[model samples]
Target: MVNRVPNEWLLYCRAGFEPDLTAEITARAHELDEPGQVVAAESNSGFVRWQSRDSRPANGIHRGLPLMSLVFARQSLVAFEPLSLSRDDRISPVVELIKESGWNFESIWHETPDTNEGKSLSRLAKSLSRPLESALKRGGGLRRKAGGRRLHLFWLAGDAVQIGMSFPGNRSEHPGGVLRLRHPADAPSRSTLKLEEAWHTFVPKEAWESRLHEGMQAVDLGAAPGGWTYQLVRRGMFVYAIDNGPMAPGLMATGQVEHLREDGFVWEPPYRLDWLVCDIVDKPMRVIDMVERWLIKRWCREAIFNLKLPMKKRWEEVQRCLTRLEVTLKAEGIEADIACRHLYHDREEVTVHVRLKGER
Candidate 1:
């Protein structure tokens, strides 16, 4: 029920990675023969817009370049309007514009930038959502059905706003492309949230009970303090927590984990394992080699690892490592679905989730 602007895209990404995202978007636009320019205000400002150079009408970016195929962005939308609301009552103008467009929305999300000032808008956005929905529903511009699309209100401020539309399954389910996860009080470390977020992203909840069952074996590389190990043992899986440092008392008391004082790089899995995890502060290439070995040699069925990035040429490093992994997987005739993300909780690193791809 929503309309897309011709050759315009709205991409949401992590803060401080705006330049990398801009480059990624421009490259894709060129490759698709739809060259465009990116309009961004500053670095680490959260979201950016892609302006198309082509005057001819087209389907925008959802035709072939799906959001999942793009690594730099967290979520993307096709924009239809950009307005300047320099008044106090913003809902009137926003509603009027949406009504004039002659489109309906299944839902509406009031998104803000991932900056300090942006975070302050949360209260205002919450207060505005109900009134906005009421206005849209009264004007017959809102429909809570699968056939309708979602409306995105990128509220940069009271005066600047962008109206975009995203189809279901084509955009992030998490608001503002940020996963709002709660930290467990008993969790060994903050790193636990990273693995928890990974589970929600790559694996389905129903499958977890079966796939990560009791007595299943797992290896936690560099698992000092046992953050990732905490998640596995909580699920009743037998974990080999490999680290030279001490672990949390609560984690060890569970009796589901065995602390191994050894180097993660030099040690090898005793046998095939269900899960192999790594979260070490090291070079990206070395970690890639270890993951490649485990997967190539069939030492584990699945893995979740972290790759530390150098500040300079960060995206280039991601692409280089990605290419290496893809090439090896293809040569080995192994079917796998690998997903990576610059998580909201992560800083200067990305979390990867890899699993065997079931044949059709």
Candidate 2:
């Protein structure tokens, strides 16, 4: 069993979403009966520090707040108090702290916040990472094995850091919870990265071959300029691109896409399709309603869509939409695996993926 730590929690998010993420985490903690106070939440900080009132191992906050279940937080870990390190001997103090914890880590990641200031610490992180690893190895605090805990060293400044650890299978695999993907040179637009990131974030890598294979039929709503359609074509799937706007000439030339000049919200697929993707810039509720109809009627086996959130109450709106969608689907006897994430490539929106259960 994974060891449960104390009350402190560290959550990372987008640069400008500190408030929203704090609110969401606070509300969630209350709902889980682990009410806590925010220790630090600066505007555009790209991170939040919260501590629960009850620090008991049995009632630890992380027990209720699995990182994956959270919408606003990109990464979450059990954190200790921030350390003020000596400029000349940063590695010794950090290494000593790990030794004092009496815990072994499978791997260590030197991370920073996702902001301009945070980016500036990259060089320092790189400079210290090698020596830190060497020290941990010499001290026997580092062990590479299955199911071992992962260590995190969060650099807040050149001489300040927050040390944490996360259980395997309970935290993001990427450092800082950001997956930096290269934009395809031939893609229609940057929006293509959103869909690509969605697939990587939501789908298990081992299941990709069967779930997202060649010759599958897909529909791309609001596919103007074919950004999303390009992904489908590249995957060897036939696409019905729904939009009155023009498509990319190169994409259309692939002979795999059929562009339909029609309003996406009004158009219906002639038959059930393998995939349904939408990037319509519409109200969150409207997008949710449309996606509901498609799933309720079994129009598609799976779906990936975006919900353009309002300026205010972004987290609340996301919860309402997700709750309504799940409740509606359950009421209709439809079982599905639903997931949503504020991906690296997404802004002002969240990507959602829904896959019907017990379907091949």
Candidate 3:
């Protein structure tokens, strides 16, 4: 048996997650790590915490950090303690296991109505609002020595809340609570931050910005409604939007986008593209083939695409695709960087990014 249990769990969940989905994740986590206590959790933001046990890792982040290396496996890491990735990066099964375990934080071992998973999220949120407000007042993710600072909160839909006080030291506080923010008196506009949560989950602004390739060219397959294209255009990149459906008026008006009424699978770019982005609601293999063809033919320098996931064995499916891509690329004597993550805006699918090894 373990000597001590964790005090809180910080769950990281995808953005815009639903209540039922959150419940399912909690139930699944419970099934995986049984009898252990769940101090707090959220379903939307793609994170969770549970009580520590004898079986849990002693040094939470020491063992839990390696999952960053293998995140493509389509599962999540459970950190028993807080983790800062700037320190360590490794690849080992045991390390991955420990990293996975630590994320399921250990809530306070108290017998209370809030201990129940169903209502614990709201209860925890109410409890921590006081401290969080204090932290915010002082400028979250910041130090007191610095003057007034901006407070940033990354709340998973139903997962754990991460409150960052940005000052010199950039202190971040996770008090195991759900976050509650009051809406403004007036209706927010497009540039306002109000709708940010709906578009992206606890995704760091840097991550989102980095994903954009400005001054780059892209090919959009089935780019109707232009959701993905909107992102690309905002970055100042021209896109070849290929779809039979009508694109959003805003995207079409940009004049940076070109509409082509052609089949995404058979269409060929008039010129080599800098990027290839697709949101085709097609089968996994078919999309995979397009990506493969692009890489093999060297049609594009980099690419970002989506894979609509199946209901069952989702993890295995992602693994298989990754493996196949790796193997194929290797056999072809090609080098590339690949990443797949469940983005804040994605649903039942994952966004994939690929760049040739040598290209910037």
Candidate 4:
């Protein structure tokens, strides 16, 4: 029978995205599903939280809900799925564990030719079995009927996988469609370890590179070693590399980058900037404050930054921050497009991209 799971983990990061931050990711896996037994989670870092209904105790410790609560309480489920594991060298143990589980294997969704070879079908099955069982156990006619179909695998990133018991109405891997990188030059290779791979999955290379206009100005806060700045410079945009430390020679040598050796919070741009980018290791509140200053003050025309989340109350805090920011911006008569995504390349942090309306 087929089972369905979450497409993304929405990794709960504590003030930054870290590849090793598996606990928050695990919590998110359980957080995504309704009636699933967490069969087994990868024991090492706890990134992979697998759930099934086949009499196995869901592995690892769930954060808030007790076992009884899941069984007895009317928990409002928002589509839970197990996290997927990815690394430079090792095969994800979750892949193996899912095979060990009794759930039948199925196809994958949104998988690309380059990555399709590495896809693990059985592993995804175990992670989704519990959720499927729940739908059947609940006697939801459509959901149960859907469960009878073959399973489908859709990898969201290293932190999450989307398991579908039925085929998607449309076969597109990116159901939301593609987000091309604003600049192709910004596409860092697999060797570029500093940037996460998932970012590329979310932001396509052709789109982004083509979108970058020649004279756009941008600022990179805390741009030491300049991994992100490298993307900007390659776009042929003038960038203010704001940080106290030295940027990589390659990024600096581009001449498109201007070193700004001042505190990100205290520094002011000489004029309005096209974009404000920050990847500082600080409290989410601080990042919010930085974004607020830019938005409320009209310091930049657009922005892309990261908000490092704290454990335990990540969703609440993100809501609070986003709500407050939206209110603040509205109060200031600013209109902008804002989005938060757990990019494939991001660890512990969520990326924010905001563009003010009516800006050319």
Candidate 5:
């Protein structure tokens, strides 16, 4: 049987974004005083591995790598695997690894890659999840309650699988870091999904009933075709769609949208607002400045915006922008919760989710 000792960290990302993730992980390890290097990561592979050359790195400093601060990776874990498919008892090794973890797993999650080839393993995952659960239960490894740790089975290939574990609140709620959202038929364009994903990522689910309700005030900068505006209107918000181009007629018919035929950069909202969203194709820092003004000047209570990134040194650029955002906010004595992520729908950009820090 072919099996390798598992000693590397596994990170799953969008297929084409492995490099961004690899760069962030390498950078973060160095920053955290963890001396390690990315052992292997190829474009479109959906995963990256960081191998630490020195065991018990950095004199055993208990530092948790800043996984949440990352802009490219989707899901991350420390794992080891690649069990032989030829073994008659392939499931035995997988179960054995889980037992050895010494965790009281509350649930089991089986995930496949994000590529078309990855989808081929879905049926296999479905078939295995229940059996694995049963075995774990029989072995007293599965917890009866729902709040304990969870186990992750990542299927990287037909013959290769990686085993890992994650805490419930600390890790992503979606399996494999992919959020499954249905495209609303009436939405102007797919771009609407980006804002929706941002809300879901940054806002807690239980608070949705109160926070995303009717009569909210919002503005969509560069909202030409009105995808972002469509989301606010759907939630019964009166929106100012700022752009120089025409908007979707369906959105206008709602009578809640004010189509501002002017530049979002120069335009300002007439009154204080509940939300601000920007999707302009401007320089990243410029976009940051635009969003920061809305927050610092108290023009809007919260915002979600995108920063168009450069071709090279993308991770460094992201770090710089985040730092500037934090420093600017601190200098002004503004309390705000800021979160950024490279969403599944984003391309060459990352999305920011910000709200007044007073509210949860």
Candidate 6:
């Protein structure tokens, strides 16, 4: 008989979003036939720990949960039980565990939750990182190679650490799954980072030249102050900025943007556009409806938009909107790729990217 044991998984999310991530993971686990219970889900903790119902091996949970399919989770990994260490020698046990596991890692990430308490542990994590790496190297457990698994040392306290591993392509590239970006000096608003991060998250870097190249015609709905429009302009795309509100003088001076004082909801493009971006603050369903209409009409080949979610049942609302959009597109025989994420720069909204297949 196969030996079965409970499995634990760690998921990181934005503080105050722990409930949503827990609900989502529970629902997903049920669907995958791997029912589990939350072992640790403190409100505003910025992290959650879940364990299976003692029915499968440790690897079962990892096989079932794909990090990309989860909207709220910033990062997910197979985590071991927390370890209590002496203040003097925090490195030896961790090195011993990796050596015993017989796993090689491409790199090691010393992480902490995205919270005030977590921030306080940063120095502790940093101080131990080099010694830990050196110890792991001495133990022959650390090897830097492309496509290798990444070992994570998540610090919960001065004496508590959780050891975990995340697959290369299946996990966020950044530590704690937060992509820290520097704001450009000339950008009109910090909101510009949302669109910029969306591109980095959804679109492959190699395809940027072809997909976001020069001379492309684009449209920015709700383009006031031109945060989103600035990204397109910087990429050398000619933009039709649609809004009744005044735009930034610097963006207009670039001669790459044509300001159209019109309502984004009702305006129609004169011809097909290469890209369509919307950052309108409205009901999530209403925004989704407009985006659906644009795609069905073939008004744009690709789109990046935001869905401002409701306070209650945010994840459920997102599911309903995405499911309906996908089903409607399928009924109309439109092939497209859709991805959504609760971006680092986003507060009460999620960024979505959709690209129609076979459309240049």
Runs of candidate 1 with Cα error greater than 4 angstroms are 1-7, 55-59, 146-148, 358-360
Error of 3 at 297 (Å): 1.6
TM-score of each: 0.92, 0.95, 0.58, 0.54, 0.90, 0.95
* Candidate order, lDDT descending: 2, 6, 1, 5, 4, 3
In Å, residue 309's CA in model 3 sits off its true spot by: 1.0
Which digits, one per residue and each the tens of the lDDT, describe model 2 over residues 190-274?
9999999999888889988998899999999999998899998999999999999999999999999999999999899999999
The CA lDDT at 159 in model 1 is 72
Q: What is candidate 3's lDDT per residue for 54-169, written digit by digit as tens?
A: 44532343133222222222222233343222112211221232333332111111111112443445554455445544433333222343353323333322333232222222
| Model 1 Cα lDDT, one tens digit per residue, 1-360 | 223333467888888888777766677777887766776637778887776665332345555567767766788887754677756788887787777767788889898888888888777778889999999999877977737588888888767778877886677788888788999999989999998887877787788876778889999999999999999988889999999999999999988899999999877988989999999889999999989888888888989999888887777888789889989988999878888777777888888888876621
Q: Alpha carbon lDDT of residue 248, candidate 6?
A: 98
* Model 4 C-alpha lDDT versus the unseen true structure: 0.51
Candidate 1 TM-score, true structure as reference: 0.92
Superior by lDDT: candidate 2 or candidate 6: 2
lDDT of 6: 0.87
lDDT of 6 by residue, 184-248 (tens): 99999998888999999988999999999999999999999999999999999999999999999
lDDT of 4 by residue, 22-108 (tens): 333344445756344333232222122335444323322233332212211111111235445455412233343344343443332
Error of 2 at 320 (Å): 1.2
Error of 1 at 139 (Å): 2.6
After superposition on all C-alphas, the RMSD of every candidate to the true structure, in Å, is 2.7, 2.8, 11.5, 11.4, 2.9, 2.5
Residue-level lDDT for 103 in candidate 2: 68
lDDT of 6 at 309: 85
Q: Highest lDDT, which number?
A: 2
The CA root-mean-square deviation of candidate 4, after full C-alpha superposition on the true structure, stands at: 11.4
Model 3 regions lying over 4 Å from their true place = 5-11, 14-214
